[model samples]
Target: MDTYITNKIMAVITTASNVSPGGAPVFKCQSKDDLYSITANLEAILDGIAHALNDEIYIIVKH
Candidate 1:
């Protein structure tokens, strides 16, 4: 099987102000891919959920 990788961020979802030990949300996963790929990844990442996964999701491009 072939794999596609283009710099990704390891994301985590939480449901509390302070995530204690053994209480951290699962790692969702983020990326620094192209616009189309980024949107598609975000869409799939946030699918079927009715709550804000995190405080914010951002990226910084160094160029």
Candidate 2:
């Protein structure tokens, strides 16, 4: 697992949970910068989200 990729995923989860009501039990990624950084390694980010949430989650990667 790449540290850069991990950090990006963490950023996504943090941002999404903070914006959503009740902090829904789902993973989300909506940062264009972050998305662009991990465009070539999306699978790693997605995998990180799944592992971090420990449940099925949604990912919204902005181009």
Candidate 3:
């Protein structure tokens, strides 16, 4: 058996303005569609996994 742990956040994509900019880079999108589009692109470009925290927020994490 094998196991792995992922805890690093590479980036953030969100449609909400209230989200605070933490240690990772934050990308603000104008709409839900834009958020999804950018998140997907970043996931591929950054070689990370996209995790939907909610309808308006997504965090890219490296595995």
lDDT of 3 by residue, 1-63 (tens): 897546789999999999989899999999888998999999999889999998988999988
lDDT values, one for every candidate: 0.36, 0.39, 0.92
Query: Which candidate's TM-score is highest?
Result: 3
Poorest 10 consecutive residues of model 2 by lDDT?
49-58
Residue 5 alpha-carbon offset, candidate 1, angstroms? 31
Give the winner by lDDT: 1 or 3: 3
User: What lDDT tens digits, residue by residue, belong to model 2 across residues 5-54?
Assistant: 33433332333444463423333456645544443355464454422342
- TM-score, one value per model: 0.24, 0.20, 0.86
- State which candidate has the highest lDDT: 3
- Write model 1 residue lDDT over 1-63, tens digit each, in one string: 996533333333433335433422343334334333443454466442223334433331111
By TM-score, the candidates rank as 3, 1, 2
lDDT (C-alpha) at residue 50 in model 3: 98
Q: Poorest 10 consecutive residues of model 1 by lDDT?
A: 54-63
